[model samples]
Target: MLNTKKLLALTLTLLFVFALIPAAAQAAPVYRTLDEIKADGTINIGVFSDKNPFGYVDENGEYQGYDVYFAERIGKDLGVKINYVSTEAANRVEYLETGKVDIILANFTVTPERAEKVDFALPYMNVALGVVSPDSRVITDLSELSADDPVIVISGTTAETYLIANNPEVKLQKYDTYANAKNALENGNGVAWANDNTEVIAFALQNAGYTVGIPSLGSQDTIAPAVSKGNDTLLQWLNDEIVSLADEQFFHKDYEATLAETYGLDYEDSLVVEGGAVNAK
Candidate 1:
């Protein structure tokens, strides 16, 4: 019913449109790299806004914590401005994956499951699981805790997972951050608070009425700076920086300066990371 010349022209147009579709679909979205951050004169770092002794804002509304100290140094070394993004334990990885932060300096533990999602540099700190209870009535053994007694832990943390997988009967009262869980424990909301041993030890030492019963749980692991997956350039830069710090025992100095007063005993060798440290071994 159509003219031959007109049908031929329409067919050619359809073919041309189909060819352009593949080209458009094949176009890749531009992703900024670590080098781009340096060129832009600003590096955004993600940190926990409420997690104390690690990352928090002081009375003056200025960020201050062990992690903040490290972030400042990274910015200084890079000769760029530092922008802080307040994050939570659960959101740290999402921040990196979405390019919301160039690096996550928050207290992110290295795990096999998480390693698949992001790249981790050499460890700057070491940690294990621990449980905390009131000094007046501390729990020394896993069997000591009552089946009815609810244990407070941050949701999605290793603490919750460890108890769920290992101790089936233990009741868990999960919160989202250290501050909330600390408050719950202070109010006698739970029988105990379980988390990274480093946090529990610090809390017990700083607050007079609390004590850490389980000093170590599970395997020893390291905390490292994390970047988005496939971000080898940024990961390499962080690794190099960490290695350089190891050579001078920078984290040792960091612990003495920031955490020593919180942890009464001399724990330099236990908590600090020395030069030539590697986790792959």
Candidate 2:
């Protein structure tokens, strides 16, 4: 009933529609599975290059820190080499979503909001907010701050989110990197710096003339590794890896090797979470 030319046109339209189906399916973000990563012989990990005692680069240009130590162990266990990718606090999610890095170990805190975007492994560390300011005029309380006195916070961090949600009246000076936030505090760009208690405590210990006026703020939280959303294979592997490492007391060893020099032995029990058991003795 159809002319030859009409039939030809209809066939071409069907082919065009079918061609778009595969292209559309491929357009979604792709993540490597555990088997695929093993096949690749190298797993890319995202970490901060400036956050010391957690994730940073040494003068020798080698990546070194608590997170880096864990990353190294992951690589060794997976029988793969590691490719470290420097990531900032704000870009951690993007790195995972785009497959730029297979895992994020940059002191990433587990939050319900982040959980929606990335799959978080079991916790490896505990954390809370703290404020550090010059000893000359310590800010012991957020209420002590004047409306004009800005608090320094790193963008995309829980500190920023907490302050914004809890104390919207307080002014904030947001920086993109830990180094810049530290510089701003040193240069008196803000009245105080708000960040993870571990970091502010480390700062107060390492540098002179600064004190953590409020040593603990907000609810206690846990830090964990994160992978792309729906990457259940890697997520399960990381969870199992963490649990297996507990038998050997791996996280405690990690803290002693990297953080004890900064926080001393007093904090080891409080900060380190062994085998993903947050409340384990």
The lDDT per prediction is 0.82, 0.94
Clashing pairs in 1: none
Top TM-score model: 2
State which candidate has the highest lDDT: 2
RMSD of 2: 9.0
What would you estimate as the lDDT of candidate 1? 0.82
lDDT of 2 by residue, 1-281 (tens): 46988999999999999999888556666799999999999999999998888888999999999999999999999999999999999999888878889999999999888998889999999999999999999999999999889999999999999899998998999999888998999999999999999999999998999999999999899999999988999999999999999999999999999989999999999999998988743
Worst 10 residues of 2 by lDDT: 21-30
Q: Cα deviation of 100 in candidate 2 (Å)?
A: 1.1
lDDT of 2 at 231: 90
Assess every candidate by TM-score: 0.84, 0.89
lDDT of 1 by residue, 168-240 (tens): 7899998987788889999999999989998998888788989898899888877788888777887888888
Measured over all alpha carbons after superposition, the RMSD of each candidate to the real structure, in angstroms, is 10.0, 9.0
Where in model 1 is the C-alpha error above 4 Å? 1-31, 276-281
Model 2, global lDDT? 0.94
277: Cα error in model 1, Å: 0.9
